[model samples]
Target: TPLHLNKVRDPDDQLVLLPHGLLRHHCCYPGCPEFLRDLRTENDLDAADAGKAGDVSESTRRNGLWQHLSPKTWYYARRSDAFLVPRVHRIARGVMDEAQTLHHFVDLTMRKLEEELRGRPAYAEIQEPWLKECVTALYGEYLGIMGV
Candidate 1:
């Protein structure tokens, strides 16, 4: 069957359709085999180039042209900060399973912030505080504690 990318929800889900590349969450149960095998019984899928179909990078770059080039030039640093903290927190807990410590969470959050900040200059300035807040929220929480 030709699985279209539109049918799949996300990249990881798309990756699962490839030969033996399914992402599995380890239960880490001492009794269970080192890792329990996650069986995929369905056949829906996507092509390898699904993510490259759109001009995502170009679109982001174009959108960034209007942003401030430096943090000092930003009029709403606090507003950007406010928007970032909770968004990152929710994203970290939801995506990373809240497995890492706060320090680790913050570090990862910063990395993601930088990635998003990849716009020219203004986006970076705005992303810094939001990433920091995200890390703080996720750092101490244990797995399953995220309740995301």
Candidate 2:
């Protein structure tokens, strides 16, 4: 069965979908930093839009690459039935490893945040604002993780 992905919404609530053919085209290619940066910018725009809406629904947000898949396609993916062609798979595997590394960095950062906040007063109860400092620390950690 051919897979169909659901429409994914961008920051402006514009519907977008990476057609299956395009996925096949790019799957084998290593993702460039510029391409990833553009995607991040688009996601930031979506977040801004959602914030302005004041009641953003989950459906309006992109959930990473999975957002490109329709429910049925996602199901197939989960079942490991949706696979890239062999040559594409080899390329995609490297991409997947990179993605995993990125995710691990994020997880480590989250853990660092938790450790830093462990004994601190809860955000609501804090008398002094520490958000800026915490954000700076996290951003520094992120940059270090990215080796930038």
Candidate 3:
């Protein structure tokens, strides 16, 4: 805790301190869990707008409450978590969420480019006439598309 996070040697190892999280003093700092109040549902009600008019029951709840069950309660919870985890991860990574596996084609394309280029290409300070012409043309086209 004595050393600052910015002093970390690895660039990628440093936390992505984007806003929302950056607005906070620390990420995931403990505070009161906000959820409270009550929820009430019953298996009896087919749907609220189903228009099956018989007398249904009223409801009441204290500190924390949940209805007994709904027909698709398990399915709802499953789908909810299916969305929530990835969202949390995406926010944590500053919107650069990655999947478990990179597609073979993308990997192959990148690898082929790497092999063809030998190492990172140095477009900056390009001395060769052909290479400088290519870079200038590419930039000219980019500026044209950008309407500059």
Candidate 3, residue 49: lDDT: 25
Clashes of 1: 2
Task: Tell me the spans in candidate 3 whose CA falls farther than 4 Å from its real position.
Answer: 1-116, 119-127
Q: lDDT ranking from best to worst?
A: 1, 2, 3
Q: After aligning candidate 2 to the native by TM-score, how far in Å is the CA of 88 from where it should be?
A: 22
Where does candidate 2 clash, by residue pair?
Answer: 5-70, 6-70, 11-46
Candidate achieving higher lDDT, 1 or 3: 1
Order of the predicted models by TM-score, top scorer first: 1, 2, 3
Error of 3 at 64 (Å): 63
Report the lDDT tens digits of candidate 2 across residue range 73-116. 42332222233111222322223324445455434433444444
Weakest lDDT window of 10 consecutive positions for candidate 2: 20-29
Weakest 10 consecutive residues of candidate 1 by summed lDDT:
20-29
Residue lDDT tens for model 3, 1-148: 2025447535423333333222111222122132211122343123322434533331111111123222333332233121111122223222112312223323332333334444333222123344323322333333343345
